[model samples]
Target: MTRRRTHLRTTPRGTLRAVTGLFLALTLVLTATGCGGDDSSAAASGDGKGTITFGYTADYSGAAALAVAEKQGLWKKTGLEPELQVFTNGPLQVQALRSGDLEFGYLGPGALWLPASGKASIVSVNMLGLADRVIARPDTGIHEPADLKGRKVAVAEGTSGEMILNLALREAGLKPDDVTKVAMDASTVVTAFSSGQVDAAATWYPLIDTIKERVPDLVEVSETKDYYPKLTFPNVFVTRPELARENPELVKKVVGVLKESGDWIAKNPEESEKITADFLGLPADRLTGSTKHVKILPSSELTRLSQDGTVGGWFDRLADIFVEMNKLPEPGKSTDYYLSDLYASAGRTDRT
Candidate 1:
């Protein structure tokens, strides 16, 4: 016998209601056996008695120096035990957050939109200092941004480095099509540049440091500093909405710790550099230059940064750029989709 497909429109509302009731009954039974959980099982307390996993993506191996501040108890000062997970790039880190594997993590500002669109919601709670820099081998004959045209450049695809490259190209009166984009992971870009496989590479610090070491003739053609007043960095801390709602206090504490750590870093640059080097397992000397230039933004200034449309607006601008690049569906309203609630949860209102 063949089974007939039930048409809800053909059935009376009362009949439809009865069928829905039966379906709900079955669903409840399955849920009880497989999905139901108590508060303890669902959320862990972090009184230093239990572990709350804090995820982070830092350049542990390649750009290890850049991530030193984060890896070395910067988050812990806020009284949270963070389990730092290192990845080569932000895209993978964001993917882990969407899969529910991370409670919080750092990702490039551009990658935050997909999660903010309700597929998965995350808030940008903290902004790491701008860490991106663009470098080129002298042999490539590239002296300026305009010189990049027709040259093969290596950058991590779907990352801030790539985004910066695109923006830089436009500023130089060139389009992305004007230059060859060689997609490579950030970790490998340094080696690729050293081997002459790529004409130029755009990446963040310690990779930039490494490239400089191998190619003394290499020159920094452009940097965030040059574009700044107009350019913004790509780093931000993000967390899941559910966790932020349940543990707002803990979130505040974590932010406090990061702020304290930032102060310490500013005051004791040499010691902080050593701690960062130890944490990343890199030779302390190679990281000295990178650390000297590193700047940690203060949490107190976050309010002003948000209010003046610097921090929040940066994300909004990045979303527009993503749309123009066809990386996102369309640019959505920042108020509707961004992590304003997380900021509020942190007791912040003036996110300028």
Candidate 2:
């Protein structure tokens, strides 16, 4: 089960495949799916022990913290064997998470909404800010939000980027039908916008930074914050209820690993960037926006965010947005499913 960590080349098309190889520290890769008890809270390794299948979508930097933690030897120290099953997006990971394949998943708030509806619970928050955005060419004369009307917007289908684009339109007093929707992958947005293939596009960090670099006339039209102040993509650490309850020790340890990883990222950024870039298969310079814009909250901050209602409050807002957007049937209460209790208990949990 403990296969070596091998570096997989990122394809231009952005299709995901199961990866295998080994890193300097303890790293394992696997492609197996068998673990959940359909819509139950016991979505964890049966005895709170054994190899953990971690489902991840690494196309975005928000989920890179897991790679950082692994490279830094945090998972090994926690006595937990983490076998990461690579994924292309949250929906794919959610499918794996629901079928009892993934014990842990890292995703943005928009993606997290799907699993939260199930037995999954988001335990910690990380990488929140202006990571994703709407970019357009200045020549389009789209200087203001209102100008987006009648524009051809390239938004990746089935992604947080699209969700943000819709929200941005709603904030601009525009409807989804106001503009021409050119469905594409997030990776293609940059070329689509620059080549005039689309007048505008919704994309994330490295691409956001890239367009600014490649096209000087590029104007970042909007982001998560411009529409809704509380609406930013936060990579919430989600798990099944039982994982947080039965495996408090493991949960706390994983949180500790994340805190250590964040600390390492902040302190040794230059080196951290190199490692992350290698793992993500992007240029080190391309990752600059990620470290600059994303806030990798440590366990301490997560505890505070939980205690102060920030985590729950943010989730509540997202749920409302989804409902209003007609993406969900109804808005669900945060307390009903969110295991903010995990963050509350992470600090006091007996880790022995």
Which candidate should be chosen as best, given lDDT against the real structure? 2
Tens-digit lDDT string for candidate 2 (1-352): 2222222333323222111111211122222222332322332444434466666654434446666776766666555666665554455565666777677776655565675465577766756756667778878988766898999998775456766777777778998889998977665777787778888887766567667776777887887666433556666667666666677666766666666676666667567767765665555664454466565555666677777777777777777666655556777787766666655665321233
Error of 2 at 192 (Å): 3.4
lDDT of 1 at 165: 77
Clashing pairs in 2: 4-21, 4-22, 5-21, 5-22, 6-21, 35-100, 36-100
Tens-digit per-residue lDDT, 201-233, candidate 1? 877665576677788888677776665544565
lDDT of 1 at 133: 57
- Model 1: CA > 4 A from native: 1-50, 58-96, 108-131, 139-141, 186-188, 191-199, 245-247, 278-287, 324-326, 336-352
Q: What's the TM-score of every candidate structure?
A: 0.67, 0.75
Summed backbone clashes in each candidate are 9, 7
lDDT of 1 at 116: 40
Model 1, global lDDT: 0.54
RMSD of 1: 14.9
